[model samples]
Target: MNTPHTIVETTLVPHTAFEEATQRLEQCFSYADGASEPICIALVGESRTGKSRALEECFTRHAPIRQPDGLTTPILRVKTPSKPTVKSLAELMLRALADPRAYSGTENAKTSRLLKLMNESGVKMVMIDEFQHFYDKGSHKVMHHVADWLKVLVDDARVALVVAGLPTCRAVIDQNEQLAGRFLSPVFMPRFDWQDTDQREEFIAILGAFQESMGEAFDLPAFTGDEMAFRFYCATGGLIGYLTKFLRQAVWNAIDAKTTTIDLANLLRAHSEAIWAKDGPTGLPSPFDRRFSTAATDDLLARIKRIGIPAEEIRLPRSKAARQTGALGVQAVLTAR
Candidate 1:
């Protein structure tokens, strides 16, 4: 029986966009209730660039930026509303407020009630994710309305807004010039650029470091040259998320075979299975191409290699056969460099 070894949990990698966004996100939690003015931030990036993950971190952490005051900081996170209309948007706010008495009667009245709830709840920030749907499916009129409605919400609620979505979401915000002023900082997440040698090398170093770290637990060999790296770069356009998927798959295959070290053969086999990524392992691209991740590949892998994990040194089978044989205590994989 073969157990899947490729599946990794919480892969470690330095995603620049995610890192930069963390600082800006901290600002949202920094302000006190009604003490600071409103702020708005937009996350713009192509598919699979980790924009969603950056926004989702706040939700997963659930720790609001505490202010000088002892009061708990308030954070409201919501995805774009389905069937977004002035009415629906208002209702969405009401629901997220989780305050039953916040809204009542007609739309206008509900808006008033929602404003009251925001004030009453001391809500400091509102994060709307997947906001690009309106631009993708709705008309110009709908887009404009959503923009105007958001501005009004920001002013009335006196809370910051942090939105994350696809690059098309940029078009939606640009259309509403007023909205741009509201969100002065627009985070742009782009695919990894392989043309820059220094950048590529730095990324490689990170992966090498990681290899060292994991070496104690597993014998992952050093990745030499640009052959496989370039191949992965071409397929992923340097997208961190995509690169990780490819490398993880390769390592997984090597482990399953119980190979002493990862090599090009195992990598190719893994690439073939990554149909959504590079040309499949056999170098064939399927009709579909939709895969993504958030960490740069080379950089991430290098970091793994540098961690200097301790792996039990293996003796050559033939030479050691003259004596008793036994594999001993656990250790981490160490970096050759």
Candidate 2:
């Protein structure tokens, strides 16, 4: 297990889209307190495209700046439950509202209580991440009801809803005309494209900043930002979560080995397990991680390396391999003629 020597400062950077979205959200408040509603903007994208993190930060900034009741509590942290719906969604609002009756009422009562709470709290916007789970209730009836329920609550409270999720989330909301109407803007989170020079530069800067934030215990040296960013691009195709996990794990693995340097070797080893490993450092972790073998992990890593490609992708085999690091735990090299 690798432990990160340095911590990462995730707050300093602001993704462009998130900044724009926040500005639009702030304007939603100018509408009548009870009559104006937020124009729902569906934040759709592939997994790990920086959508969730960006939205969270933007929303937190927009929330009322009041301190929470407890010294430890921070006001304006939006709530997202394991299972979301009209009733459960209501409970989340109640909890956000700190309403004691949050648990006292039946499901409908809870929903009603939350709408009342929303209006009282002046919550102009409600954002739901992982909005796709709404369709997973094992029945379409529940899905439709959840949509209708959201419509009613939003209409009643006159607040905007920002739903962030995979593309499938749009389909769910599309079923509700009113819900779809509320969504005037559809923001898409595209994977970081190395093809764009400007995006690539920003990406590298973020990596450098992350390294600095992690501090000296992190073995990663300050190199030309572009070099570090390009290296990660090859490994992860600029997948945000994958890139984050790989970097953090590389530092952690370096720490575990009592090493003071994070090089290609350490990065590759950590990258393999932290991302493609069944344990999945960040993504929906594979259940098999706890029971799988190194070979299984290797296969998964290779497969990820194979996506969007046919059987033609070259695999660097062990027989022609140059060397291996035991703690890094994986080794493969592309062959030269």
- TM-scores, all candidates, are 0.64, 0.69
Top-TM-score structure, candidate number: 2
Residues 1-337 of candidate 1 have per-residue lDDT tens digits of: 2133533325445556678876677766575355455778888876667776777676556554555753243777778866566777777777876656544567778878878777766777788888886584434443677678778887877888888877667777777777876666688876655556766775565466556544545655464344545545555555666556766676666666776566545655665575353222223332122232324477544432221122345766655644433222122222322
Clashing pairs in 2: 2-252, 3-252, 6-214, 7-214
lDDT of 2 by residue, 1-337 (tens): 2125435324245556555655655555345355555456677877777677766666666555444632221122344454565667777667777888776778788877776666556566677777877665345433777778878777776666677777777777777787777777777776556667777776776666666665555555563355445555555655666667666677677768887787656666776767543323334223222232223244454444432222344667654234445323442332321
Lowest-sum lDDT 10-residue window in model 2: 69-78
Return the lDDT, model 2, position 223. 37
The TM-score between candidate 2 and the true structure equals 0.69
Superpose all Cα atoms of candidate 1 onto the true structure and report the RMSD in Å to 1 decimal: 20.5
